[model samples]
Target chain A: MIDNTLNRRQFLKSSVGVAAVAVAPGILLYGMANGSSEGASAKVRWGMLIDTSHCAEGCNDCVTACNKENGLSGGVAATDSQWIRKIEIKEIAGGRQLSLPMMCQHCENPPCVDVCPTTASFKRADGIVLVDKHRCIGCRYCMMACPYKARSFVHEALHDQNPDVPRGKGTVESCTMCVHRVDQGLQPACADACANKAILFGNLNDPDSEIAKKIRTVASVQVRADLRLNPGVRYQGL
Target chain B: MYIHSAVLFRNRLFYALVALAGIVVLAGLYSVHLMEEHGHIITGMNNQIVWGIPHVFAIFLIVAASGVLNVSSIGSVFNKHAYKARAPLAGLLSIAMLGGGLTVLMLDLGRPDRLLVAATNFNPTSVFAWNIVLYSGMFGAVAVYLWTMMEGRMKPWSKPAGFFVFIWRFILTTGTGVIFSFLVARQAYGTAILPPMFIVISFAWGLAVFHIVQSAIYAWTNKVLDDYVQKRMKNLLGVFVIAALYFVVAYHLTNLYFARQSDFERFILSDGGIYPMLLWAGYVLIGNVLPLALIYLPGFGKSYHVNLASVLIILGGFSLLYVFIIGGQAFPLSIFPGFEVKSTFGDGAISLYYPSAPEILLGLGGVAVAFLITAVGIRMLDFVPHEDTKKFH
Candidate 1:
């Protein structure tokens, strides 16, 4: 009342204070709602633990789920692309036979990422390995470098692809651990589809996570550990 | 009148050869078009056997291209009058073969249209990326080197240029070897000796190519390569062939010493069907032994014999590469060291590959391209070697 006619400095300060108060809640809510929109976080390392004892032989539920979810042709021809394959392995000396699903090991030091000529093969901050098809020149040097033979070059054109996953001919591709679902706070297709609950998916870096607890307690191993690749995927039984 | 007619006949024959090469190049282009439309499924390459006959042709052209320049290096760098006379031709062949080899490599890509992407998006960790730089640098370096030799004003720069080329080719060949040696997972590669082996192999393959081309040129011009020069070159070729064989044997011996690699060594040398056959019959016997006999045997040192030896060496080079590149891939990766793995994806089994018609045509196209380039270059310029009679005497 005493200073009804305000000065320019006083008016400017009042406007800034009003704007901050009005915008703070909206900004906070946006941050809270769209955590993944900021891009993958380095703090989280996604991983999988598979128990081969629980995995049933002649059952390919994980492979089927992956093929459907990823919109694969499900053909087993030499030229056909198979993201996840059911491998039946027998110990040469022991003669112990077991069937397990094999896919990209998602290594800490991925040879595919290292040998990619165009830097198209990359590892996400959240420990997901992916091929940026836009930059892929289809040279297939990554395929040659991969230790696990996890990569497959698209030999022919594709049609009716999953809207979530865009793939094309000539470019190389491999398992993504269903990156789209992981961002939405859901398990991978294979993990969800495992009828016997053999597959466990969680954050490896999070000490309290189930996968982390299991890995710490049980005997889990990475395939080809001698390569010193430190793969995120772990197996529970031989 | 007779001289005029003879000149006219030569011109006709040259034009016919050019037309033939042009047709082959066009056929190759058509095959590339088909591959682009349908994809690599049309070819023999698959998930397991990713590289096929096209790689063999491309790698051969590339390796030999670098080797062919050895002639110029001997002349320009070492100051050998006889070799210097042949330098121009050597330089010309090097450029032609490189052009041909790179063409096949680029065209065989899954996304050939994305060549610009490979050039722009550089990954320093990759040997493939390094190869792009090395290959392009070679073209530029050799071009400058050639100019220095041909242009009178640029003569002074030739020595430095030759020296640079000599070092560059070594690095270039090393880079090629590193492409395989860096594969840590593959049983057939990941050894340090591969680099030296490739270098020695290049010496023999490159000289063999030079001999064939030089002989063809001499025959067309109705000129005789002096007996002394021919003997010296043939002897050099013999030494190179022996050296190459030595390195190859050493490579196998080293691999045999390793326990893990024994399975792969066995597969290539004895067990693997076509691979063993190609290595023994195609490479060792036909490519090496017969060629050696033709060149060094008491009675068989004729010019035709030398040419025949050169041809056999080239054939042997192809056979060795097939075993190296294709056979290397045919053997499965040992993912589970102590386990026998079976999958729908051809795991734990030998992968089969049969090169299709289009694949062969595409490879042949590369050879045609090199031929066309050489024919055009020689016809346009004085690339034919002319030795001074007095010097040899």
Candidate 2:
């Protein structure tokens, strides 16, 4: 109304200084969001634990299944917009060479959420960071924000999408952890395809579930754990 | 339009641009064609380097576009005449730069038909989302600035628009750097210098575009560039070369300083490495440091050599970025330590990313679109200040 653009520039002219003054209140809100002051007192805190040892050679079943279920084009194109991919980690010197399936580790303190100007892919009450495809402008910042190369962009439309695979164009997407199927009491596409039954699926909060059991029994790892994302997917032997 | 104005084309520069533009466009077209015919499968980009050339070029173009404001902002904000004449051209070029960048990027996409979705469906947290807004906003800002400048109305909005556009342009470039820098898990971590590097690349590429476009405008209009303005543009170019060189060194050295990512670092810098000789020879020496030296040396001030340095500076900056985007994605997460994966790093990746035949044709069509738009813009809007811009012809 009152030339906000110009007024905004004035504020921005001293932006660094403004940032300093803004930090205190910003930190306050941040701490609350991070569940630091309230420690384990947030609503629906979703987490992950990946058993890396389970992600073995030629075992890109999760990746393949995710692609098929997601209706992603499996082609020799320069980019596939992979929602999840199997990462082969030759851990420096013979640290039990590992192949772990990496996905959108749905971070608790999601940087993807932090940088989004529109608040489209906000962290929900249940803590699974997701994109509302309807609201998505498809800028791919989430792709950049994700430490794991998890999100994929729907750069174009499919001629005939596989009826089984969930597909869309003009928006970015990722391992919704099969949010659609999860809502209907179905396991994720990957967990369904895993032959070794290596892929464990269950609520992390449920103390006796197989996912929780594996986490407790085996030494598991999460990618970039230092970032304090408290990932839902934990890995074993990674 | 005076057809008899003095400083028109004399042999080298214009012809060279025509050649460069023609070659780049042809290459882009051919590559896109290759991608389309064979599918993007031809591109060296696997899931690892999902964003190889297009991402880098897109960022490069955006950064260059952002820096196009340097001359104008300094002139308007600081009120220096040194770069004032070049401002309008800079503004227009930023628009062309955006178009070019977008064209290259669209060609890189798996399904370019959905480009409209970038504006329609929104992932608010996605930088790609914000970039859509930022780029659109920048295009608008630059478009208006050009209008106001051309119409002789340096209104209150004009100054702020100019200033903010300059500021946002840098932010836009920094946002691009953040796109890469934010990837903490990617081996590219430990280098926080991306934002600054984007700025330097922005300045270097911006000035290069500025110089080239200035030559074009002069060639077309048959107008002589005032010696004073040439000197100023040359000075700004010199400054950009130096800053780019400094930041390039700082960024790489900072990463090399950290022992944690050292192996990944060496893989990118040493012989048999994807980035190896390119980093030292092409990027560091030729792209940055050497060009910086050539421009800064006392004898070369304001000469054709300065323009030569600017050209090399742009190519070097572009090549370095190509190395980062392509070469960065060359090897696997070298968590494998002591194993040879593959050498399809730089030269090989370009070929690997060979776009299908239809893709190449469409890419050429897109480049045609960019050039056509620029030509139309030049004809319609007065991209140059009239002789009376300084209040006297």
Candidate 3:
């Protein structure tokens, strides 16, 4: 009766405080149990599908875009770190020709991860393989173990990195599937740059994703399917 | 004390030899410093051929280290009284060579400073991780074994110590071989025969190293290694070299049998330009056949032929490793099985690798380091086998 004139604003504020106190512990517990931040969920397996049929022979837009995206600018050569490159293929028997981009296959069972002594080479919860630069001893065992010849060792000191991609000398690196972009719900630079729409990037676990649909409906092949690595990268045409 | 007197510690020639070896070790260290400062770009190794000549030297030393311990094992484990006197020398060489090899291996890493990470971050599935434990444990086992032989009161423990190291070295070598064998992706490695093949090669190389050191020590003291001892050691070496050859043949034949692997086989066996030459002329001819002939042929083993054969075997060993490690990478991986591949990344072509001066210097530094260790250790202790050794044999 004495405080009735204190106003509805005060009363509503107290009520809100009481409600938060009652629900905050439960919310905190839920957050603690889940373990990932917003947009960093483990339910997605990021993958790419390269339709070799549509991939133009002379177009280097994807490679250039990847370089710009990843900060692999200078000292490019046969020995330099090339996260992705174009491979021209011709069947020895049939004499049929094709060209495809090759990078890390991001295998379900990667030989690189198995050979890394320091556990530097690891696969993310979302099935993206990466080398932990801090832990990579640069023994280069991963390069030897990779069937697709995917990994490259940084032989020289790096400068002017793209901030997001922290590269250095004496560590092994491969295509990360543009993980920074993926976290922000953006397509990989390579996929985005492909004008012919030959590259499609999406969560392989999602049934509705274009990559999933193509893999199911189309006859696709991994570079070395005999290894049974179950690579995340697939090609539509040989 | 008797052994120590024979070490020739005061000789000008001895000091000169030690100084030369020390200088070589310094040069090697300088090369490593340059590599660390400038990065691996200064070296011959690249993305395609990741492991280069440094590995050749390191592996050779490590393999020989395991073999050197076999001499001690013959005394303590096999109960050969003749070998008992030489146990201390063998143990010392084992430590020295292993230490040198490990130094080269550690220094060659991309992050040599991150050696602590290798110790802390253990991956159970990785053969490389297991090797750290095996190699470390081997050093401990060998040290204790050496102590048992050197200490008068600990003589009773020598056999047990020897037994431990014998088992330990086998496991260690198997672990080393598994480093290659576990690589299922490399067509040149991961064969079933690799572990045993490495074992035999270790024996051949290790015994050869032992003979060379022993001979040098005897010569320094103005004594001759007993004819009986030389003959026995030579015969054992011959058997080991022949066994190694058989493994190589069987390994190639197995690859040849598979239609999918025929190209790889042809590349290594015949068509592979340098590789075929290495296997045939280097490993098969100079390394195996000549050594065998020198050992078994009636008049050959009587002269310096055995010593020459030992040198040939070692040279052949290096060539064999070069062909295996470098040549393996040179042949392109079978990424697109039946398709001819061309890429800026050297996808379909043979990777060319020529080791630079720094690489060779770094490799030789490991050799020099091992020699320095042996020279210093022998002078400090009675590492020369007792003259009683000849009497026992």
The prediction achieving the highest TM-score against the true structure is 1
Q: Rank the candidates by lDDT, best first.
A: 1, 3, 2
Alpha-carbon deviation at B247 in model 3, angstroms: 0.9
Ranked by lDDT, the better of candidates 2 and 3 is: 3
lDDT by residue (A136-236, candidate 3, tens digit) is: 99999999999988889988888999988999998999999888776554678999999999998876765645677789999998877888888999999
Better of 2 and 3 by TM-score: 3
Candidate 1 local lDDT, B236-266, one digit each (tens): 8999899999988998898899898899999
Better of 1 and 3 by DockQ: 1
Clash pairs (backbone) in predicted model 3: none
TM-score between candidate 2 chain A and the true chain A: 0.74
lDDT per prediction?
0.88, 0.63, 0.84
- Give one digit per residue, the lDDT tens place, for model 1 in A7-26: 32243233323333234432
TM-score of each: 0.94, 0.73, 0.92
B1-393, model 2: which lDDT tens digit per residue?
A: 434333344334445655666676777777766655554556544444556556666666778778878877876677665555557877877888788877777666554555665456565555656677788888888888776665655555667777777788877887777777766555664257888887876887788767776776775565776666667667677777778778876766777887856755777778434467777777777776766676667776554566677677777776787667766555344322342222211111222343234443444544454565566566676676444335312
- Worst lDDT 10-window in candidate 1 chain B: B384-393
Q: Write the per-residue lDDT of candidate 3 for residues B1-393, one digit (tens) a residue.
A: 346545555476789999999898888889989988889989889988899999999999999999888888888888876677788899999888898899889889988999999999998888989988988898899999989888999989988989999999999999888889987887899787888888889988988888888888887766777666677777888888888888888888899998988888889989989889998899989998888888898778853787788899998999899998999888898888889889889888888888988888888999999999999999899899874654564
